[model samples]
Target: MIFPDNRYRQLRAIQAEDFHTCFYCGCIATEFDFAPPKAHWQSYQYRQLSADNLQVPACKECVALLKPCTMGLVQQRREWVHTKIAAKYKKAIGVYLKWNEDELEELDFSLHHSIAAGLKLGEESHRRSNFQGFSHEIDGSKVADVLPAAMPIVLFDKQFDSLKDAILYVCKNYPITQPKLVERLAEQGNNIEAVVMEIQEEQEVAQFQRQLKIQSAAFAKKHNQSARFVSNEVERYLDKELAYSIAEALDLLYEERVKHYR
Candidate 1:
């Protein structure tokens, strides 16, 4: 696991607070990240950049997030990592930005817990992303915030604190179940109204199928034909003609086939 000294940056903490703290997110550092990374250091052009070859303390999560980054400058690399952190917790950030402590207090236990968890995550991520570098005591200099602004979740011309809230609201208003809605949303993308319509159409088709089976069984019993035979014929006719209803298909089957037999 040892890296070459010239190739890998030397570990250094600029300030006392920087020790054991993630340079990217301010979390407790469990690992070290090589600024410009070892791979980038291989390039002669990249090595020529006035990049500080410093190994900085980073949490496991930040290390993983920076795996693909090749920025040579430490500041640029830090900003890149912050961007990833913001994107990674965008939903949580939305929740944090949308609701305050007072609003969270009004929610029921389950909902309150759900939102509270999201808010906590959002707060941590928010802090980590905005975290300025450790203060420099020389003249008491401070760093500017690095976190990007977050956008709230919006649906049906309404804004939601989080995606979970939006999904809950949709489930309440629509006949679609939450699980099915979530499943379809993953398959169909974020068009909530379209997803609702798709589920409704599926329900209608399923209901019509059940009705057809029941009514066709009754028709089969009355006409002395096998239930499967009647159902199959009716379905075939309906498939041939999109406008044909089950009742119409059954009547046509009786007229065309049953009349000849009886």
Candidate 2:
């Protein structure tokens, strides 16, 4: 299903939290880009509504480049990409931190060349008249490379309970495969069954918290009080509930897949 206007706003908020730039290319992100591609979720198995975890803000150029890399390829190449991009980011950050204004301007061309060369994106990047806004190109690759390698990305400013849950969430919400999830978790040396257990516990906690909030909200409304007057406790609880709900949904999705496989 298409995301509602509020969901778009939620995506925008995520971008704003990340400084309103594409997480991969560091260019201004005008749209939400699903990492696994939303098209991956259109199959009969995954035909559920999309969730925010599968998305990251990305620029048009980066999106175009990434879309061609299928999920199978992504699973295979993710580690190499992460290692390379992390090294590049570390090196770039070191140079950036050490450079003064004059030094920065002097090295701008070379930095741009380095990014274009590294990613093999081509000469279009070089044709740009200015390099000032290009600093993020390096940073963007760094972020993109690490995403698949790292589990439990912070969304809406909260860490997911486990990498398994995060992967399952993406699979349920997007068109990703069970093997891809298994591969990612394996790369991290995590047992898929163990991770699922952890996710289950987290989901239960979230469900209990959500029920409490619902009851509290109902009570306030019954007393003719403003249900909108949410206390900080309620807000915090709600955020946790949301996080847990995503994990729970992922857990249910995974169970279905397991049954199908069996």
Best model per lDDT: 1
Q: How far out, in Å, is residue 84 in model 1?
A: 8.1
Instruction: Count steric clashes of candidate 1.
Output: 0
Q: Please estimate how well model 2 matches the true structure, expressed as its whole-model Cα lDDT.
A: 0.43
Q: In candidate 1, which residue ranges exceed 4 Å CA deviation?
A: 1-60, 71-161, 176-197
lDDT of each: 0.75, 0.43
Error of 1 at 113 (Å): 9.8
Highest-scoring model, TM-score? 1
Off by over 4 Å in 2: 1-17, 44-53, 72-262
Number of colliding residue pairs in each model: 0, 3
Provide the lowest-lDDT 10-residue window in model 2.
126-135
CA lDDT, candidate 1, residue 183: 63
